[model samples]
Target: MRKYFHIDLNDRSIETQTLSGEALARAGRHFIAKTLLENDVATVDPLSPDNPLIFSAGPFAGSNFSNGNRLSVGCKSPLTGGIKEANTGGTFGFALGQLELSGLTLYGASDEWVVIRITKEHEITFESAEPYMGLGNFEASRLLHEKYGDKISLALCGPVGEYLGLTSGIAFTDPEQRPVRLAARGGVGAVMGAKKVKAIVVDRHKMPPFTDRKKLMGSIKQYGKLLREQPVIENFGKLGTAMVGDYTNTIGGMPVRNFSSGQIQDPKDGPLQVGGQFIAELNAGRGGETTHACMPGCMIKCSNVYVDEQGEEICSPLEYETIGLMGTNCGLTHPDQIARVNHIANDLGVDSIEVGAMIGVLMEAGVGDFGDEGFIKDVLTEMHKGSEKGRLYAQGTERVGKHFGVKRIPVIKKQALSAYDPRVIEVTGVTMMLTAQGADHTAGNMHSIVCDDKTTEEVTELSMGAQKNSAAADSLGLCVFGRSVTEANSELIVEAINAAYGCELDPSFVLETGLETLKMEHEFNLQAGFVTEDDQLPDFFYNEALAPSHKTARHSAQAVNEVRSAHF
Candidate 1:
């Protein structure tokens, strides 16, 4: 029998249940399906669902592998009126896995403020936390560390979430209790705040070994070997994802100044200067300190703890998304400034991508001139103060556009696009339009598909394939980084599953689950009153002519409309 605990946040209660083999299998599939379904249903509701957040760590989470540490957060995105699931690399996945918990479902509103602490041996406890109000993630982490000592892993939110900002996100503490890792997107932090729960403290003291330990270890060893042998995996570990920043900028794929241009002036002959510069500076100061693993048994320590000029820690894994959105897109030339912006976003609990895009739009509207570091700092300072202008900015791009009457806003389904410029990489635009989760790049980043194609038909087909593959990756709790080398090798994943569960499952089932999840989310959105018209970019993108590369939007309404028909 498999044990599971269902906690009700409203009354601070818990229900324990055990399931047979058949029941466990069914529940696993249902839980995965329902996560996609519930968010879809909530998308069309006028007031939105109260505290509907689903956090699921996969069956392979605790295993020793390069990519085993991934967790999924599903909720109705305030940024996009569709289901959104943002996955992150952090210790929370491994901790949850050790506790043998399949997932956590948070629902309903709470009357009194509290924080829930769960452990392998101790019963769930809802403790009053009135003293910790209006604290940022760092301070919150300090308080939790004081109480729980150094062993506990925490999932926390900050004042931004408390204010119910649309771009709020949940922050996960590193092993050292620094609030650096984040399941940070789609306003999930707000959902936690709505439940009147400030944080989730997971203590896995003396947790028992997972069932089928021998098989699990064997599969983990096999996959770990494969990951080690893979060239891309090796490269990613060494350089991380920002290695692509120079490449994207060179190809005119990097969105700059709110997609006003794709290419920026390269100080070097190649576009490698920006990425190389950041890597050099980071390494020079705190490069070799410790490339820490987000989860306990992870081998791919792609995450890093970056320190600033004073040798004080600033952020972790200063990633491509943050650099792209905050650095290039916002017209900031310096990486340190970008890092500071990233730190501010983390402290505020808002999505950095959305905030970057929001600030870009503000620059476009003369709220602050592009590349004005002083003005940018002032705006962020105001936001921290919760000023009226700050509140408007905190609402994200679509809401800000609506409030300010800016017709040139770049968004699809009410959410701003990420760092990639769709005009240069056309297939990703298709994914952004058709995905049930609005304009999320990860929903189906078709960049690789476009790279592999020689013709338009080939591009379309490969993009569709990549989209399906991404969905499958999400369903299986495997990082897309792992998928880059594996491609659609379902058998390899199935082998891992068989090793973990002592049962045979065709890897193709993962693809089916992905499709099923997508369909369920789509149906829920339709029921929630989201129409075909809602799946579109703003008209300004069509008419505006972006400079530098001098590229204008070429996708017609017919072409954009074809995305829904092709995918759905």
Candidate 2:
């Protein structure tokens, strides 16, 4: 039996419900889709008390399966005004799983500042959180650890979220209790802030039961050994995602200076200064650790620690998306300076990608100058001080672009592009255009989807297939990195799910569940007033040709609609 703790913040009431049979499909992305559709919440205002945010752990969460402990945070996004599900890696999901629980449904708004604490004994407590209000994420984490002991799983927010910044994200502490790993998209934290929650302290000490522990252990060990031998997985452990900078720049897909060009202005030195090799050197000199895991039992440790000139900790897990948008896109070549901005973004509890894009738009509007470290530092300070521009900046890239009237902003459905500019990597651009998540890279990471020969005619199928595959992985609660294993060897996933829940499921059944989840999500978006016209990239992507490659976005609105209408 799996438990669900429904915490209504309005009356400070905690209720427990049990889910079983077909209802508990591992509680990752799929479970969220089911729950959202069941509640018919798509048409409701996202920030209203009626919209519930679900925190669900995957089925293999409390087990030894590699990368098993992912937390799926789903809500009607205040950012996209549609259904949003952001999955993150960290200790929080596994901790929650120890309570024999699949998920927690958070509803109703609190009258004032509140903190929800769940203990090892399953006791839920609500307390005043105003004393800790306005504190940045790192400090708030330190104070929470001091009060709750260092091992407690914490999900917290900073001043920016409390101020309802549209880009605010929910920050979760890693195993070492550092506040960094985040469900960092779609304004999930602003929804929590609107619910009047400052932090959620969960200390679940009991693990979920496995029907056949011996068989489950054997399957996980076999899969783990197989993943260890993969070269791509190995590189992820070594270089992390920051390695994408070198390749994207070489291909002329890296957005430079707010999508004005793809090629770096100083061709000889630009890539060298801002790419992965620079980050590797910085790590070597500062004694920072690379190949760090954000979650327990993750075989692909694609994260790193970043330190300053004095070898003092600045931030951890400085990612490729942050590298591209905050580094090359802003004309910033100093790795440490970018790391500092990444750190500030984390502290402010905002999405670093959105912040970086917003800064580029401001530069385009002549409010700031690109490549000026002092100017960026000053801007960050103003955001911290809650100045008018800072508050405007917190509204995210799309709103800021609208305010500043920047034409060439690289956006899809008002959300800023992650690292990949659609001009060069055209297949991924297709995914960005058609998906309901609104320009999210993970909507279906276009990296893995390819045919024998990638052609314009093949774009729709590749993007649709990638999205379907990704949706399946999300629904299964499996890391997308693990897709090579679970997808290719579907029986392995079936075996694990059967062993976890004592249920019988075949490979096709697993595939269909994923497809169904995507359908539910698309239906929800439709109900939220999203029409066929919203499926294409912004106007500039259609008109502006990127440098070097010189290719504009080629997908016509009709082509995109054709993909959307195929009914994936």
Candidate 3:
């Protein structure tokens, strides 16, 4: 059995609920959606005290299950005005699993900012957060560690989140004590900030008991073995996610110069500097880790620690999205430049994709020159200082575009579109248009699909399949990068879950759970007054033809919604 805590911040009261079998096994994203629906969270103001922030852990958490220790943070988004589940790879879920806790929900607003600490004994206490306020994630985490100890994992609301920046995300500690891993997207950090919670500290303990320890261990080994034999997994282990940029750029699917062009540099230029191959080689030569795990026991280590020419750390993970939107989209080609900005964004606990898109739009509005490092640095500085202009910039891409009267804004449902150029990445485009999760690719990304001969309905079907798989993975606290193996071997995964929790779920349970979660989210969005038109790509995508590919968005919101309705 696992304990779920309902913490009311109004009077600092805690209520615990015990869950077992299927309930505990299928937690994380599903739990958040179900709980919110039951609590009528859809009708509440997203930033109000009534809006609960949920944190959930999967059943395989704290075990040596690869990509199985992710933590899901969910709330009604202040940015998108809809359901948001932003999961991150980190030790927070592992710590919860160690303590035999499934999840926790925070209700009501605190009278003062506080650091909520959970001890090994499950004792929850609130401490003054004055000392950590206005500090960057690095300094704040250091102070938290000094006061608490090293054997605890932290979830921090950064300086940007202190004043409820819409681009802010809650930062979680990576294995190396770096708070670069974030539950990033949909203004989750703003929700945390609204609750007046500065941080969440959980004490680490030994792994919790499993129902069938020997069988679970065997399943873990089998899963790892399967992942090892997969060629795609091997490539990811070598190059990390930056390789996606290479493929996207080559195929004219990468967003370049504020989504004006699909490709950044011409092929005549030497190797694409911002792409994964170049970055891996560069980082490796500079004594940096080209492949590293975001969480403990992740065999497919697709994260990295990028460094400067001096062999000093710039950022822990210089990912493909940051490379596409922040590097190429902004007309900056150097990884070092992107890494410096990435470090600053991480320090602020803001979503780099949103921040990057915002900067790109600012450039589009003639506020700054594209590829100007000085302009980018100045914007980040203003954000850090929480100046009036900085706060305006922090409102995110869509709002900033509106303020500047920019017509070429790339956003859906009020949130900025991710690195993928929907015009060229057609199936992913369909997914972005259909998902209630705003313009998030992780909701369902099918960028690898060859869409030249495909129909809108066909692409929507493909998107639905991918979305189901992704939803299942998110609900299970599994990383989507492991989908190649996990989706192909659902039986093995279900068997592992059964061995761990003694549940008798069928192989089809994974997709079914995903479908259910999607339905719940869709229903929540409807209740929140989201219309079919809200699920659309911007007009620029339909009217403007991207260079190289010269493809405009082919799917309409109505057609995509019809297909989705048929599926449901």
Best by TM-score: 3
Q: For residues 1-568, what per-residue lDDT tens digits would candidate 3 score against the true structure?
A: 8899999999999999999999987788888888888889888999899999999999888888999999999999999999999989989999899999998999999999999999989999999999999999999999899998999999999998989999999999999999999999999999999999999999999989999989999999999999999998999989899989888888898988899998887766767888888999999999999999999889999999999999999998999988887788888988999999889999999999999999999999999999998898899899999999899988899999999999999999998888889888988888888888899899898888998898988999999999999999999989999998999999999999999989999999999999999999999999999999998789989999999988898888999999999878
Q: Candidate 3 regions off by >4 Å? A: none
TM-score of 3: 0.99
lDDT of 3 at 513: 93
TM-scores for the candidates: 0.91, 0.96, 0.99
lDDT, each prediction: 0.67, 0.80, 0.92
lDDT of 2 by residue, 331-422 (tens): 78777878888888888878888878988888998988988767777777777677897888888888988898887676776678888888
Ranking by lDDT: 3, 2, 1
